[model samples]
Target: MEPLPAAVTAILLDIEGTTTPITFVKDILFPYIQDNVEEYLQKHWHEEECQDDVRQLKLQAEKDSGQKGFVPIPSNTEAELQVIKGVAANVLWQMSLDRKTTALKQLQGHMWRSAYASGKVKGEVYDDVVPALKKWKGAGMKLYIFSSGSVEAQKLLFGYSIEGDLLELFHGHFDTTVGSKVESDSYRRIADKIGCSTENILFLTDIIKEAEAAREAGVHVAIAVRPGNAALTDEEKSEYHLITSFDQLPLQSTH
Candidate 1:
């Protein structure tokens, strides 16, 4: 791997396939959301937060449906059960498509809180992650996470992590609300938020498009190649520095 820029003062990391295995998200988290959505919605539908999420879901469904325009699911007592069922189906479909809608992420985070609290779910990080994070922090580098998951979800994952409460290590968290990960402007915004020059932040991810976008925005970037991650194309391999482990990161002492 190429040397990280000496000017780098902050490290922005992607969760899935970078610090955490991709299968944990696809196999464990997604399936948990799918299985629990209906029950959660049914139990919480009358609450204000649940209603708000349903409204947002309806809006996204309309956008997804295009010119046809989405029909509102009736919410009256006689029809509310069917409405919940229909909305649950839409949520599942969105999950299947891996849509990064804010409302969907919020709802997922809400569900995950219960799961994590009840001991049904715990976040997983690669063996090297905690030590690497500690080393970077000790060297005075700020750490942040930029993931498609909601900021709340990001905190929950690290807070309930298998490594035990890694949340304190992170300086900040960002999600799609900031912008899509593949957009150059998002990296620029993150750089601004962190009060660092674009050139002084290093972005790490498993996706080639995200690495390209961050690099385009003037942030140094590296592609993580982890087990269970998609194989990189020859072109991608040629384009970005690839690190198979966090221990390979070229973090230098700031002092």
Candidate 2:
């Protein structure tokens, strides 16, 4: 848990199960989408943005038609009630399978935007996250986020967090649009986007696959060990640096 060497000039973080509690996503955010999606659709169905959301979801559903247990959204020609029901059912089905398709995330992002702005939901973060962010930023290191969630969804969490707006803490955010988290090329792409070499980055994530991917990209890594995250095996515990709090991960000292 010593200060990371000066060679690592940037830190890339994961959101759920890393900087934020897994329960926040599992018990709150996901449920918020489930409980309110139908009402949201009913309220906004006439709007162009909602229509775009529905179009994207229908496209996704078409591709998923052959998948087992897939739920299909009816065409607009169907009865309005039937189409609404089909869209809601499709959303629930994708969510139940924990799918991370961009279509699903786009709708969820838009919905969470409404929920967060209305004060119906607030983002959660560990108490130690902000202080450590400050320490690192003060030390002249860049910060960024890389999560499976969409960039808009990532912003909503930090922008409306319980700790208050933390959007300023990051230089940029990356989602699966860059590439899958388990692929080494995504880390390379992220490093390129941040204008740094992969060797200059340190990635923090709870998943070993992501840690391995980052390492393969020549980025340093520290696996975050947080509550509600899957337990790392004994060998993994010894193989990767494990951190329970951001406080344990000091960067190059400013002084």
Candidate 3:
């Protein structure tokens, strides 16, 4: 492994296919939502928080529909039922397409909280992640997470991980609420939020497009290749540092 770049003082990590197995998300978390969303919504629909979620999803759905008139969600049982079914369908559709809209992510996070608390789901991280995180923290390197998952969901995951609570390792979390990961401006915003120069933050992920976006934002970038991650093209391999394990990442001693 090469020496840690001299300028890097902070590390930004992506969750899926980077620290956690993609299967945990695609097979477990997502399927749990698909199987349980309607029931969960039905059980909680009258509550203020659930109602708020429904309202937000309806607004997003209406915006996406591009229709002229208002799509009213009435208070009556029959009307509420109709609206809830429509919102559930839309949420399922969005999940199927893997859309990263804030409302959807928020609602998914809400649902996942219950699943995680009930011990129905637990987060998975690569074997190398814990040791690497400890080493980096010990060496005075700040660590953060940037993922499409809502900050709440991110907390739920690390807070309930198979490795035991690992949320303490992260300095902060960023989600779609900050900006799209594919946009360079998002990386710039993240750097600002972390109070670091963009060039001083090393961003790691399995996605080439995201790596390119961070690079364009003037941040250091690396591509992580893990089991179950999408195969990288030769072009990507040639353009960025490819890391198969967090252990392979070089860290300079701060002591």
The candidate that achieves the highest TM-score relative to the unseen native structure: 2
Clash number for each model: 0, 0, 0
| Sliding window of 10 residues with minimal summed lDDT for model 3 | 67-76
Error of 3 at 133 (Å): 0.5
Candidate 3 lDDT score relative to the true structure: 0.87
Better of 2 and 3 by TM-score: 2
Q: Model 2 over residues 1-255: C-alpha lDDT tens digits?
A: 467777888889998888999999889999999998888998999999999999999999989999999898999899987898899999999999999887998899899999999989999999999999988899887899999887888899999989889999899999988999999999999988999899999999999999999999899999999988999999999998899988887677544
Off by over 4 Å in 3: 64-87
Q: Rank the candidates by lDDT, best first.
A: 2, 1, 3
Clashing pairs in 2: none
TM-score, prediction 3: 0.87
In the range 1-255, model 3's lDDT, one tens digit per residue, is 677688899999999999999899889998999999888888998899888898788678766665333234433466767767766777887876777777887788888998899888999899999999999999889999999877888899999999999988999999987899999999999999999899889999999889999999999998899988888888878999999999888878656
How well is each residue in 33-70 modelled by candidate 1, as lDDT tens digits? 99988898999989998888888887777677753333
- Give residue 228's error in model 1 in angstroms: 1.8
RMSD of 3: 3.1
